[model samples]
Target chain A: MPTLIRAEGLTKYYRRPRRYEGAFGGLRTLITRQYDEVRAVDGVDFTVSDGELVGYLGPNGAGKSTTIKMMTGVLVPTGGLIEVDGTAPWRDREKNAMHIGVVFGQRSQLWWDLPLVDSFTLLGKMYRMSEADYRRRLDGFIDLLDLGPFLDRPVRQLSLGQRMRGDLAAAMLHEPSILYLDEPTIGLDAVARDRMRDFIAEMNRESGTTIVLTTHDLVDVEALCNRVVFIDKGRVLYDGSVVDLKATYAPHRTLVVQLASGFTAARAAELLGPEVPGDVIADEGPTLRIRFEANRISAQEIISAVTSRCPVTDLSLVEPELEDVMRTLYGNRTIAV
Target chain B: MNAGQATCSDGPLRNLPAYLQIVRGRLRIAMTYRQNALFMLAVVILQIFILRKVWTALYGEAGVVNGVALADVLVYLTIANLQSWAMQDLAVGSYLYSLVREGRIAFDILRPAGFVPQMLAHLVGGTLSMVLFATAALPLVALVGTLGPPASSAAFGYWLLSLFFAFGISMLLNLIVGLGAFWTTEIGAFGMLFTLVSQFLAGALIPLYFFPDWLRTVAELLPFQATTFTPVAMYGGQLAGSEAVQAIGIQLLWIVLLAGAVRLIWSRALHRIVVQGG
Candidate 1:
C-alpha cells in the first residue's frame, strides 16, 4: 500500500494572552502585552498507508485535536511538515480538501434547521457530484446507516446516535479517498458504538478508505484499528500493531482455580512448590488464583501442581487486556517493548 | 489519480450551477422568517413616513427645502430605506464569528469550496430575499400618499445597477468586520461601531447635502455614502450629468477596493486563525 498521509517533525505552539487580576492590572497588561506560549504538538512523526485504519490515541490536552486541525487545514502549523496525499494541507487547502473528508464528533456539520437529506443534497452540490453518483451514494448510505427513518426530519430533532450516523453518511457522500474522524463514537450507547465500529471497519474493507481516527475509547480502537499510535504529552510513545502492543507491554496472564470441598490453602501451597514456577497470588474461600508470565510457565503445569494436593473442580485462564497494557505504558512513560 | 479530483477541479464556470443551488437553499431558509421580514418592512415604511411628515412641516407648505422637493426627499428616503434593508447582512458576519468562536470553522475550511465565495454566495442569497420582501411591501406603503415613481426609466435602470454594487460593498464591509473576530474578542463592539458610523454617513438618517461642508466631505470620503445615499440620489434625479457619472464611478471603485481588502483580510485571518474549543 502507498503512503496516503505523512507528518514529519509536526509541531504547534499556541500563544495565549496573559490575563491580569486587579482592575488596574487589566489595563496595565494590555500596555505590557504579555503572553504565554504552550506547545500543543511537538515534533510528532507518523504515516498512514492506503486502506489502513489507524487509531490515534492520546490523553486530554495532548495535542490530538491540534494535530487534526493542522492536518485538516483549519490551523496552520507553527512548525514541521504535513502532507495529505501530495499537497501540504495548510499551503494548499482547497486542493487538499478535494481528497479528504473530516468529521468532528462534538460539532455538527449539518445545517440545524434543514432535513437530513437536504444537508446531503447541499454537500453533494458543494462537492459538485453528479446527480447519479450522488443518488447512488446516498441510497447506499441511507440503507447502511439506517438513516431512512429520519431522512426528512430536521437534524436538530434527531437523537445523538441518529445524528452521528447522519453525520457519518454526510461526510462520505463525496467519497473522498481519506477520512479523518475525531471521536466518531464518542457519547454513543453500547449498541450504537458497536454498530458504528462495524460500519467503520466495513467502510475500510469495502471502499479502501484510509481512516485516521482520534478517540479516547479504547474499545473503538480495539475493534476497528489494525494499528494503534499511542501519544502522550505531544509525543508518540508507541506505534505498532495492536497485537504486538499487547504481546510486549502486557505479558502477564492470570489463572483462576476452583478447588473441591475440604481444600485448604496450606495444602495447596505445599503441593505447588518452587518447581511449579508461578505465584499463588490470591487464596479466598476454596479458590486460588495464580499469576505468571505466559512465556515462563504453561497453564497445565500450574493446574497439575494445585490439583495434586486438593481436588480441582474448575479452572479458567485470563489474558492481559489492552486497557491494562495501556495503563502501564502511559503511567510509566516508558516503552516496554 | 484525477478521479478523486474531478468533483472540485471543474473550475469556477462549471461550479456556477452548484453555487446557484446553494443560493437557492439559502434563499429558502431566509424566506422562512416571513413574520420578521414583514415586521422589518413595516418599521422601515413607518420610519420614512414619519420623516416625510417632519420635513413637510419644516417646509411650511412651500414643499421645497434645501433646493430639494418634498416629493424627492420622500423618494430618496423610501429607496434608501429599501436599499438599507437589502444590505442588512450583518447576520452573515456574526455567523462567521460564531463559527470561529465555536471551533466549527473547521467545516468551512475542510469543504472543497473556497470559504470566501461560499459566504459571499450565502450573503447574496439572503440579501436578495430581504430585497424582494422589502420591495413587495413597498406598494402597500406607496398607496398611502406622497411617494412617486423614479425620475425616469434611465434613472430607475441605473439605480438598479448602483443598488447591485451597493450590496457588494456592504457585504465586503461586513465581512471585513466579521474577520476581525479572528484577531480580537471585541468584535461585537467593532460591529456596533461599524453600523453606527455607516448608517450616519450613508445618509440613512439625513441627506448628505444637509450636512455642513466638513461633514459632507467626510461622508463622501467613506464608501458608506456610495452604498445607499448615492444610489437613492441617482434614482431621485438629484445627481445628474457628470455628478451621476462620478457617483457611480465612486461606487465601482469602492466595490473593487473593498473586495480587495476583504481578500487580503481573509488571507491573513486564515493564516493565524485560532478556533477556540470544540
Candidate 2:
C-alpha cells in the first residue's frame, strides 16, 4: 500500500481572546483586542497507507481534533505541511474534499428536519454519484447497517444509535478514498458499537478505504485498528502496532489458572514457588489468578510451573487491557515513540 | 478504484448542482413548516392594514402626502411587503449562527460544495418557499385591500431584476452578520440588531420616502433600501427611466460589493472558527 495521507510538522496556533477580572470582564475582553496564542496542534507528523486502519488517540484538549480538522481542511494549519493524496488540504480544500469522507461523531451532517434519504440524495448530488451507484451503495449500507426501518423518518426523530448508524452510512455513501472518523462510536451501545466496528472494518477490507479514526473508545481501537497512534499535549507519543503499544506501555499480563478442586492460597503460591516472579492476585478455593510482567516471566513458563506441581483443570491467559495501556500512556510522563 | 470519478472531481462548478439539491431540500422543509409561514403572513398583512389606516387619516381625502400620492404609497407598501418576504432570510442567519456556536460548521466547511453558494442557495430556497406562500395568500388579502399594477411592463421587468439582485444583497448581508459569530458569542444580539436596522432601512416597515430628508439619505446610502425600497419604488413608478435604471444599477453594485465583502469576511471568519462545545 502507498501513503495516501501524510503530515509533517503540521501546526495550528490559536490566538484566544484574553479575559479581564470583574463583572465587566466578558464585555471588556470584547474591546481589549488582547489575545493569547495557544498551540492547539503542535508539530505532529504521521503517514497512513491505503487500506490501513489507524487509531489516533489522545486525552481531552490533546490536539486530536485539531489535527483531524486540519486533515479535513476545516482549519488551515498555521505552519508545516499536510498532503491528502498529494494535494495540500488547506491549500486546495475543494480538491482535497473530493478524495476524503469525514464524520464528526457529535454532529450530524444529515439535514435535521428532512428524511434520512433526502440527506443522502443531496450528498449524492454533492459527490456527483451516479444514480445507479447511489442506489447500489445506499442499498448495501441500508442492509448492512439495518437502516431500513427508519430511512424515511427525519434524522431529528431517530434515536442516538439510529442517528449514528445513519450518519455513518451517509459518510460512506460518497465512497471517497480516505475516511476520517472522529469518535464514530461515541455514545453507542455495545451491540451498536460492535456493529459499527464491523462495518468500518468491512469498509477498509472490501473497499480498501483508508480509515483514520480518532476515538475515546478503546474497544473501537482494539476491534478495528491494526495500528495505533497515541497523541497528547499536541505531540505524537507513540505510533506502531497495537500489540507493540500494549507491550511497550503495559507489560503485565494475567494468567487465570483454575486448579483442580481443593487448593488454598498458600498451596497455590507454594506450587508456583520461587522460580516465577508472578503476583498471586487471588486464590479462591480451586481458582488461582496470577499477574506477571510478560517480559520478565513468559506465560509458557508460568503455565508450565503451575501445571507441573498443581492439578490444573482449566487455564486462560489475558492480554493487558488496552484501556489500562491508554491510561498509563495518558499520564504526565512522556514516552519516546 | 473509481474513487476519483466517484467524488466531486469536476471542481468548483459542482457547487451548482449541489446547491440546487440543497435548495430543493430547503424548499421541502419550508413546505413542512407551512403553518409558520401562514402565521407570519398574517402578521405582515395586519401591519400593512394598520399602516394603510394611518396613512389614509394623514392624507385626509387629498390622497397625497409630501409629494407621493396615496395610491402610489399603498402600492409601494404592499409590494414592499412582498419584496421583503422574498428577500429576507433571517432563518439562514440564525442557522449559521447556531452552527458556529455548536461547532457543527465543520461539516459545512468539509464538503466539496462551496460554502457561500451553498448557504445562499439554502436561504434562496426558503425565501422562494415563503414567497410562494405569500403569493398564494395574496388574493385573500387583496379582498380586504386594494393595490394597483406596476407603472409599465418595462418597469415591472426592471422591478424583477432589482428584486433578484436585492435578494442577493439581502442574503449576503445576513451572512455577513452571521459570520460575526466568529468574533463574539453575541451572534443573536447582532442578528437582532441587523434585523431592526435592515427592516427600517429597507422600508419593509415604512416607506423610505416617508422618512425625513436626512434619514432617507442615510437609508439610501445602505444596501437595505435596494432590497425593498428600490424595487417597490420602481414598481410604483416613483422611479422611472433613468432613475429606475440607476436604482437597478445601485442594486447591482451593492450585490457585487456585498458579495465581495462576504467573501472577505468569510475568509477572515474561517480563521477564527473556534469549534465551540468541543
Candidate 3:
C-alpha cells in the first residue's frame, strides 16, 4: 500500500497569556505580556498507508485529538510537515477536505434543527454530488446503518445512539478515500458499539478507505485496527501491529482450573509444577491458576498435565486483554517498544 | 477516489449553488421558531405605536419640522425601525463565537466549502428570516403611520441597490466580529458593544437629520450610516439625484473595504484556530 498520510516531526505548541491567581488576577492576566507555552503535539512522526486501518491510541490529554486536528486541516501545526493525499491540509483545506471524511464522536456534525435526511441532502450539495450518486449513496447508507426509522426526525430529537449513527453515515456519504474517526465509539452502548465497529470495518474492507482512528476504547482497537500507534506526553511510544504489541507488552496468559471432589488447589499446583513451565498459584477453594508465556508454552500441554494428575471438572482459558497491555505500557514508560 | 477529487476544482463561482443550499438550510432552521418570530413582531408593533405617539406629541400639530413633513418623518421612522430590526441580531457572530467556544467549529472547518462563504450564507439566511418578519410588518406600517411611494421610480431603484449594499456591509462587519473569536474565546461583550454603538450611529434610534450638526458629520464619516441611514435617506428624498448616487457609492466602498478586512482577519484567524476543549 502506498503511504497516503505522512507526518514528519509534526509539532503544535499553544501559547496562552500567563494567568495570575488571587487578588486582581483577572486584571493582571489581561495586561501580562508573559505567555506560558504548552507543547500539545511535540515532534511526532507517523505514516498511514492506503487501505490501512490504524488505531491512533492515547490516554486523555495525550495529543491524540491535536494530531487528528492537524491532519484534518482544522489546525495549523506550529512546526514540521503534514501531507494528506499530497496536499498540505492547512494550505489547501478545501482541496484536502474533498478527499477526507471526519467524525468527531463528541460532537454531532448534523444540523441541530433540520431533519436527519436534510442534513444529508445539504452535505451532498456541499460536496457537489450528482443527484443520482447522492440518492444511491444515501439509500445505501440508510440500509447499511439502519437509519430509516428516524431519517425524517430532527437531529436534536434523536437519541444519542441514533444521532451517532446519523453522524457516521454523514461522514461516509462523501465516499472520501480516507476517514478520520475521533473516538467514534466514545459514548455508545455495547450493541451500538458493535454496529459502529462493524460499519468501520466494512468501509475499510469494501471501499479500501484508509482509516485513522483515535480512541480510548481498546476493544475498538482490537476489533478494527490491524496496526496501532500508541502515544503519550505528545510523542509516539509504540507503532506496530496489534498482535506484536500484545506479544511484547503482555505475553502472559492464565489458565484456571476447578478440581473435582477431594482435590485442593495446593495439591493441583504441586502436581502440575514438575510437568509444566509455569507459575502455579493456589487460588480460591479448589481452583488452581497457572500463568505461562503463550509464545514459550502451549495451554494444551499445561491443561493436560493438570487434568491427568488432578481431578479437574471445570476449566477456562483467559487471554491477555488489550487493556492490560496498555495498563502495563502506561504504568511502565520505560518498557521498550 | 478520482471522482471525489473532481469536486475540488478551484473556482469561487462553481461553489455558489452549494453555498446557497447552506443558506436554505439555515433559513429552514430559523423558521422552526415561529413562536419566537411572532413574539418579536409584537414587540416591533408596540415600538412603532410608542414612537408614533411620542413624535405626534412633539410635533404639536406642525405640518413640518426641520424642513421635513410629519407624514414623511413618520414613514422614514417606521421604515428605519423595520430595517433596523431586520438587520439586527445577526446570528453569524454569535453563532461563530459559540461554535468556537464549544469546539464545534471543527465541523465547520472540515467542510469542502470556504469558511467565509459558509458564514456569508448563514448571515444571508438569518437576515432572510428577519426579512420575512419585516415583510409581515409592512401592512402594519399603513395601519399605524403614513405610507408613501419613494421620491420617484428612479429613486426607488437606487434605494433597492443601496439596501443590497447595506446588507453586504452589515453582514461583513458581523463576520469580522465573529472572526475575533479566533483570538479571544469570549466575544459576547465585544459583540454587544458593537451592536449598541453601530445601531445608534446608523440612525436607527433617531434620524441622522435630528443629530447635532457635528455629530451628524461624525456619523456620516463612519460606515454605520451606510447600513441604515443611506437607504432610508434615499427613500425619503433627503438625498437626491447625484447625492443619492454618491451615498450609494459610499456604501459600495464600505462593502469593498469591509470585505477586504474580513479576508485579512480570516486568514490570520485560520492559522490561530485552537481547538478549545481538546
Candidate 4:
C-alpha cells in the first residue's frame, strides 16, 4: 500500500492556568497569574495510505482535534515529524495547503452572505481553478451532493446538511489528494447525516482520495469507515477496524421482547434459560430484555426461541452503538494520574 | 499558452486562484460587503475630521510652536490619515490568529514551497485592500485640507524619507504584533498593547514636537514615532539632512530586527504549538 501520510512521534502542548500568581514574584505575583503545561498531542505515530477512509475517534478533549490540526499542518508540532505526500507541512504552508482540503464542523468555510455557487467560484479562484475545470468539478459535485435546491441560495440560508455538502465540495474543488475533516456530520439531521455518509462512501470508492476525519457520531464510523482509531487522554486506546472495537468492548447485543401481558421476569428467564448466550435484563415491566453474544447464538435463533416460549407482542434487536463502545473505551481510563 | 496555460497547470488550485488571483480574490472580498467596508472607510474619515478640529483649536492659540506653522500641522495630519491604511501590511492579529483557529495553516506548513513566501501571498492581498481603500479616501481629505490654511514644505526631502521610514516601521510593528498569536491566547491583549503604544507615541493624538524636548527625543527613538510622528514632523519642516537620514535608517534597522524577532518567535512558537496542545 502506498503511504499517503506518515506521522512519527508527534506531540503538542498547551499552557493551562496553574495558579492566579506572578512570574516576576512582585506586583505580578500578587495579582496571582500562573499557567501549567498541558500535553494535548503526545507522541502519536500513524500512517494513512491512499484511498483509505480512516475514522479517527476519541472522547471530548482526547487530543483528537489537536492531532488533526498537526496532521493538516494547521498547528506546528513541538516534536517529531509529519510528512504528508512526502513534504514537511509547516515549512511551506501555501504549497502544503494546495495539496489538502480541511473542513471544520464547528465552523463554516462557506461564505455566509454569498450564494453557494458564488462561494465556490471564489474558492475556485483561491485554488486557481481554470474556468472550464471549475465548471466540470462543480457539475459533478452538484450532482453527487444533491445540491440543486440550494445552489443559488446564500450559504447562510442553507440547512446544516446543505452547508456540510458545500464544505465537502469546496475541500475537493482543488482536487486535494488528502482531506482532513473535523466533525463533518456534526449537528446534522438523520436524513442529512445518512446522505453525507452515502456521499462520503461514493467519494472514497471513486476518487481514491485519502481522508482522515474525527467525528462524535459513531454511526458515521460504522456507516462509512472500515478502520477506526480511538484516542483518550493523549493516547491511542484502540486502532484497527470497527469489528475490532465492537469485539473488544461489550461483545454482546441486546434483544428486547414485549410479551402479551402476564409474564414474570423469572418465568421468562426460565423459558429462555437453555439458550442463554450471556445475561438477561428482565426489569422493563411487560418487556423482557436479553443480552447475548452475537457470534455465539444467532439473533434469529434467539428471537424464534423467545417467540415460541411467550406470545410475543413486539420484538427488537439492537447491538451496541459505536458511541457506547467509545464511551466504555475512554471512560475506563482516569486522567488524574 | 495564453488561455490554455491555466488548464495544464490546473493542479491543487483549480478551486482557488493562483498568485495574482489570490490578490484579486481578496480585493473582491473586501468590497463584497459594501456597508461594512464603507463603515470602516467612514470611521477613518471621521477620525481625520476630529484630528483636524483639535489641531485648529491648538494652532489658533499659538501661531507656530517650534518652527512648525499651523497650516503645516493641518496637511501633515490629513496625510497621516491617508497613510494609516498602510498598517495592514503588518497586521499581526489576523495573520497569526487565523492560522490557529482554522488550522488551514497546516496545509501551508507541509507544502514543498517556502512558507514565508506563501504567507506573503495573504499579506500581499491584505495590503492591496488597504491601499485601494486608502486611495479612495485621499481626495476627500485633500478637499478638506484646502479649506484650511496651507503649510510650508521646507523639509520636503526629509518629509519623504520620514514617510518611507514610517512604512517600514509600521510593517515591522505588525510583524511583531502578529507574532503574539504564536504564544498568547486569542490575541486580544496583544492588540490592546500595540494600540496603546501606537496612539500615544506615534503622535496620533498630538504631534511629537508638541511634547517636551527630552520626551520628544525618547519617543523618536521608539518604533511608534517611526510610524507617524517622524513622517508628520518632516512634513511640518521639522528635520533635514543627517537627522532625516537617521530617522529613515533607524526605521529600516528596526524593520530588520523585528523581522528576525518574528521569525525566531515563529519557529519556537510552532514547536510549542505542535508539541504542547493549546
Strongest candidate by DockQ: 2
CAPRI-style grade of the A/B interface in model 2: acceptable
- Model 4, span A170-232: residue lDDT tens: 888888888888898889998988888887787778888788988988788888889988887
* DockQ, 0 to 1 scale, candidate 2: 0.49
Candidate 3, residues A233-256, lDDT tens digits: the string is 789999999999999999999999
Q: Pick the candidate with the highest lDDT.
A: 3
lDDT of 3 by residue, B195-254 (tens): 889988999778899999999999999999999989988898898899988898899889
**Candidate order, DockQ descending:** 2, 3, 1, 4
Fnat: each model in turn:
0.53, 0.62, 0.53, 0.41
| Residue-level error in angstroms, candidate 1, position B163 | 1.2
Q: What DockQ does each listed candidate score?
A: 0.43, 0.49, 0.47, 0.33
How do these models rank on lDDT, best leading?
3, 2, 1, 4
Tens digits of per-residue lDDT for model 1, B169-275: 88888778878778875667777788778887999878888899999999989999988898888788787668888888998899889988988988888777877
How far out, in Å, is residue B15 in model 3?
Answer: 0.8
Docking class of 4: acceptable
Summing lDDT over every window of 10 consecutive residues in candidate 1 chain A, give the lowest-scoring window. A328-337
How far in Å is the alpha carbon of B100 misplaced in model 2?
A: 1.8
Question: Which CAPRI tier for candidate 3?
Answer: acceptable
Q: What's candidate 1's DockQ score?
A: 0.43
Worst 10 residues of 3 chain A by lDDT: A328-337
- In model 1, how large is the Cα lDDT of residue A287? 74
List model 1 lDDT by residue over A211-320, tens digit each: 99999888888888889888877888889999988888988888888878788655676677677677776475777778888888777777777767678888899988
Q: Alpha carbon lDDT of residue B261, candidate 1?
A: 93
